[model samples]
Target chain A: MKLRVRHVSRYVFDAPVKRLAQSHRLWPAETQGQSVIQWSVETENAVTGSGFRDGAGDWTQTVTVKGPVSEFTVTAEGLVETSDTSGVLRGHRERVPASAYLTGTRITGLTAELRMAAEAALEGMDAASPLDRAHALARYVSDHVVFAPNRTEPATTAAEALEGGEGVCQDHTHVLIALAHAADIPARYVTGYMLSTEDSQGAEASHAWAELHVHGLGWVGFDAANRCCPNEYYIRLGSGYDASDAAPIRGIVDGATQETLDVSVAVTDSARQSQSQRQQ
Target chain B: MAQADQNFFNEMLNGTDVRAAYENLDRWQANMPSDLRSLKQHEAEQLFRRVGITFAVYGEGGDPERLIPFDMFPRVFTADEWRKLERGIKQRAAALNAFLADVYDGREIIRAGKIPEHIVTRNEAFEKAMVGIRPPMNIWSHIVGIDLVRTGRDQFYVLEDNCRTPSGVSYMLQNREIMMRMFPQLFVENRIAPVDGYASALWRTLASVAPKKCEGEPNIVILTPGQFNSAYYEHSFLADLMGVELVEGQDLFVEGDFCWMKTTEGPQKVDVIYRRIDDAFLDPLCFRPDSMLGIPGLMNVYRSGGVTICSAPGAGVADDKAIYTFVPEMVRFYLGEAPILENVPTYQCAKTDDCKYVLENLEELVVKEVHGSGGYGMLVGPKADKAMIELFRDKIRARPQNYIAQPTLALSTVPTFVEEGIAPRHVDLRPYCLVGEKIELVPGGLTRVALNEGSLVVNSSQGGGVKDTWVLAE
Candidate 1:
């Protein structure tokens, strides 16, 4: 499937931001599952700085703007060809070992409740394969937490999400990753774009999931919020220990008394390519 | 109270006979009048105060900024002695750089089973952000300060390695300056090797590691945390001496894939940053979100080769006390050479047998935190009382992985002027090694003397003082 994605994030401050700097992981991962066709990231009234592929197999770029004026906007547009690989992430160059992912983060640290839930999910299935256990844990997370937008804050931990019993994809990914680690499997949180079939207009596109490193299969993606593994419709951008680390955009504004943020992302199938092929 | 051990090696005296290194100084002292000596001492203190050479002591009730007492007696070293120290310091620096590059890139040492995987992976000093980001010239620690302690005439052991930002080079320079000013005749009589070239050498070392994108002459600046930092004087002093702009985080920004310092005229591209801030506080967007002392996208610029950060982020892992044990192996593995300097025999409390031994010998060992610095969070076993030893035992039992124990060596002493006149005081040396295209160091280093009688701790914050180190010309 060929998908085109456009993501825009704007920040407005009540007072002028003396200085602003931002880091973006907006480019799609170059792996067997996805191939980048073309990608461009730009900012208004800001200068886009150096870009590099980081150790985590993510393309990161820096942006900075000096302003006595208020608003700053970052726009990322890209086209990527993706294929279904049974949710298996392959051929991604990362220097960190699988054991490094087992290190729990502040947001995904396993609580007693998370540990119990993970144990319960794998009960009577001790003889199953690691992949099977990972899938079972994903299912357990999906069933335990209802998908409800605005139910939790960005800093909400897996323990907090489990107690609340409802959260968005971020919370769901954190909970699943916590459980995966509790089961002694290395896991990480992934942030990317998902082409939602229900939203034909391709709005509400930003998504997050969890990836468990199964011994034989390598890293396998699992989306507990959708109760399935990511397919051709998903574009993987980056992975980290938790939501904060995996955030597509991390930034800081200096000398601003107050600031407001707005984000919009759209992912849709490219009709122009299909039309061109039909004409040919 | 404990007393100085008579068996310890004294740098100035051997069985009440002055060593050959101190012969000239001893003769000069005998000829000098007592009133003139006191006058010179007062002049030295006045000069230090006038130059604004002071260190900030946090959490202290008295004045925060206090001058590190300067001793007039110079610690002299023969050319042969200095040659060995120079070679060892260079070898250790090279090995440390090689270790950092390997750990971040391939982990060949870990794979070879020379060092444990968990020790590197689980270490808090091991930054995940620096996993595959190689710095300019593949050198992580551009400047290193290796702490050396002497127990005997030929026995020098590395106590710790400061791969991160090492302070006291400024003190080394200032001590020499004050000595030359107070006693110009002594400098002419004794062919002391010149140390005035360190600032230029440091500037060249930083310039040699500029990013590939830097064109022509690389623009260099010193990034300081601010005046409140304990090492602020060194920061400003180095910057002035190197003839570069001294900037705080607020004075710099990232734009157009490059880091720019906001000059009085406008923004100027910065190619190299001699950063004195810690890694966690170097980039807010990458490492710590709440850090106001760091530029937001500085790490991204660094990873992209836009600006070179001297002593690159994550270099701290190589100096971690737990990892220090593997440096010898690194020397053999990376350089195919034996370590020129010996590491003090260390007992890692994390290991079962080592923990058992450390706990059993708590009264005879000096236990230190793996991550602690500046003589903080340490227990000198011999001086510690029973309750203090017991307290450390409980702390060690709770987190065995965080502690390391070493037998207290009888540190060598130098003759220092005290209230009761010249007496022996324990001392240690910290030589600054600059690594870039090549490893270079001045012959002499900062020799810190414990002011208190019989005290072995030489940290300035713990009532220690500085002395001029003289490497005699051949």
Candidate 2:
């Protein structure tokens, strides 16, 4: 499946910033599951520098706009061809040891609720394999946390999300990651783009999922909010221990008192869109 | 007034005979009158205060403004002894660098089953972002400060290793400077290896590890956390000695491809950074977002070979206490040689059997936190009361993996100037080994003397004082 994605973020500083710098992990991953056709990430009045692939196999670049700038727009548009690999992240280059992902971040830290959920998910299936257990945990999170938007904040912990019982893809991913860790499995958060199928509610501009490191399969993706493992329709970007580390864009501005953010994401199935255009 | 404890090895004497290395020092002390010795001690203190060398070492922060006492007596070592120590220290330093390079890359030591995987991979000091970065010269720790305590005439044990921004090299230099100023005749009478070459050697070592793309005389700077830091004096002192810029986080900014230092002339591109800040505060974009004390995109520049960071991020993993136990193993695995320096027998409280042994013999062992540094969160069993020991026991039990216990070895003593008279006080050695294109160390080190009588901990925060270390010419 070929996917077209356009992600643009606008930032308006209330006061003029002395300097602006941002680190972007917006490039699609080069793996067996995906191939990049064309991609360009650009921001007006910014110089992109120090671009390199990180230890987690994410291509990151630094964007610097030195000035008393009040506003700017960062736009990333890409066409990527992906394959259905049964959610298995194969042939992905990463140097970070699997054990390192077992480390929990502030938002993905294991809480008692996550532990109990993991235990309950695998209660009768004591002999279930690690892959099966991961699936069961993902299912448990999907069934428990109903897909609800604007119900939780970005800084909400997995424990809080579990208690709320209503959150979007980010909360579902955090809770699943926490549960995976409670079961002594290594897992990380992945940030990417998802095509909004008609039936899939709340498929927004961007999507997040949890990736569990299984013994034989390496990393396997599970999107609990969508209640299925990610397939060709998912465009993998990068992964980190939690949302902040895996964020597509992280910025630091010098002496900007207040800033406003505007984000837009449009992901479409290229073949279907082309067919509709032909019909038109 | 001084009791010559026969149980502890006295460096100045060997069974009632003056040691060969200290014979001249003993005669020098004999020739000086008591009042003059006292006056000279006062002068040394005044010199130290005038020089503004009052800050503490590492994270052992007491009163940052208080001056650490300068002992009039010096610790002496013979050429043969220092030669062996140099070899051992260099070997350990090489292995530690090799371990770090491997831990971030192939991890052959872990694959060979020499060290456990979790101990290295799951360590809090291990930076996942640094896993694949190939640093200049493949050296993570440019300056490896190995804490050593001498037990016997030929026996030395490494207490711990400091890989990141090891402090007190300034103390070593200042002590010698003052000692020479006070007693020029002593320098004339006894031939001591000059330690002034340390600044030059350090400069060369740092310059040698500049990024490959850096052309000509690579510009370098010392990145300090600012004036409020406990080790700020050392940062400025090194920068002055090296004739480089002493900069704070704000003084440097990342531009296109390179990090630049703001100067009166213009923006000077930095090729190497001897950063005295912690890794968590080195780059705000890559690390803690709340940290305002770091360059926003310095790590990215480092990753792309625009600049170099001395004692690279994640270098602390090699010096961790739990990882310290495997130094000898690393020596064997990486260098393919026998370890010249022996490690103290340590017991991990995380191991049930070791924990039981440690619990059963609380009074004879020293318990230290695995992650704690600078004399913090440690229990000197012999020095602790019952209540203190009980407190440590519960701490260990609550988090066994967080603690490690070792036998309290009898640290050797040197004749130190005391209120009553010269007395034997426990001392330790921290020799800074430089690694770059080559591995090297100055003959002398910073000798920390426990000023409190009978105390074994040599941290400055805990009644520890400074002494000039001398290596005699053959």
For model 1 the TM-score comes to 0.90
Interface RMSD (one decimal) of model 2 = 0.8
lDDT tens readout by residue for model 1, B202-286: 9999999999998999999999999888778889999999999999998988887788888778989999999999898999889
- Model 2 lDDT tens row, B240-296: 999998998899989879998888999989999999999999988999998878999
Highest lDDT scorer: 2
Give the whole-model CA lDDT for all candidates, comma-separated: 0.87, 0.90
TM-score of chain B of 2: 0.92
TM-score, candidate 1, chain B alone: 0.90
Residues A165-258 of candidate 1 have per-residue lDDT tens digits of 9998888899999999899999999998887765221123368899999989999999988888988988999988898888888888878468
Pull out the clashing pairs in model 2: none
On DockQ, the candidate that comes out on top is 2
**True-vs-predicted CA distance for residue A174, candidate 2, Å:** 1.3
